[model samples]
Target: MNRYESMMNHLLVQFSNTKVLQAIFCAISDELQLLDDTFNNLKEKRWIDTGEGAQLDGIGEIVDRNRLINNAITINFFGFENQINTTGFNQARFREYSEPYLSSTSLSDEEYRLILWAKVNKNNSLCYMNDTIKSIQFIFKTDIAIVQDIYNAKFIVGIGRKLTKNEILFANALDLIVRPAGVSCQSMTHFDKDNVFGFYNQKFAKGFGQAPLSEIFSNNLIKKGYVV
Candidate 1:
């Protein structure tokens, strides 16, 4: 999730009454727009397209370096950085152990622990979680464990946004799957049917719950009578 997405989701969790939350949502949305110049959700459109038949399937599509013409372009989103909450982290963790402590074998585990975290003023129906959500006037409770290396680690935790199309392209080009912390599947609604896209469908069976995002693309590109 982007910072704004996180904020919106957290807002949903915070308030029960829908009507009251709308005002707050609007205010935040307005403020975010004001910050768009410096910290934007999408890149600036500064390039003029060439009149030639330069073509790319999508805005972020990779072009053939040797192609006679290509219309590939890059977008940059100046997103906000995650703000670490040391106090909130401490409160969330079990205070009994000063250092990170978990009773597991030598085998390291990085399960659904990579799950995103959010703040709630009171305990509502959720999943495996931290201690409290009402203490801090500001700041959210996000997983910070993904970046840490703990002996006999039981879970993985991360706090970051999902990969954009351009980012996925860069990672796929290198044949390297960016980890959960760095990138995740884009939402299905954002995808075009035949474009190469990544998704995280939880179909776990083996000892691993951490499934890398999968890609789909070009399956129907050469249908019998399709455009040649």
Candidate 2:
């Protein structure tokens, strides 16, 4: 028998008058199953939301051995628009859902939260911000074990609101006012002379890609705030 069944059998033998407890355990199991179903549905829908940006219009495979290593919620689903190389992802950090990769990395709490909200939603095409990716990402792995949602919770400085499971994906590219509604959100794609200059002159004056994002100068302008 499985672990749960074995445990229940042991409990029954240990305590003769424990029918109520067994019933309660059974009910708890049912509730947990329901929660599992709901979580799966939500995750699938979210993955679908990334369809517009993913390289493949349809994702299908037989072996499906390769894992999409991503920390950026949007990048996880959509991939990159112009570069198309996988921005917003750290490979090493993707070890949980993905097979281990030496080059992959993880994100800071604030960074992860911001990227999550910026993702496209099935209900609303608009992106915002949130902390839902970790739990949603882990739904597939939690069938046999209870996966804990571990994340450093933080706020979007733009809205000063705590993030929930559903929200938008923030794009550093959103600051590029030149691009139209959709393309502008692809920060890894566009180039805004003014924004780039500003980011360079003030934030990373040492030259671009010199320092870690957290080490950069601007908190409000770069990470949290919504700029035009």
lDDT of 2 at 82: 31
Cα lDDT of all candidates, in order? Answer: 0.27, 0.31
State model 2's lDDT.
Answer: 0.31
- Per-residue lDDT of model 2, residues 61-179, tens digit only: 21121123232232222223332223445531222445321223343433333333333221233323222222222221111211122233321111112222112222222221121
Question: Candidate 2: where are CA atoms >4 Å away?
Answer: 1-102, 120-123, 126-188, 195-228
Q: Write the residue-wise lDDT of candidate 1 on 48-73 in tens digits.
A: 13111222122112221221111111
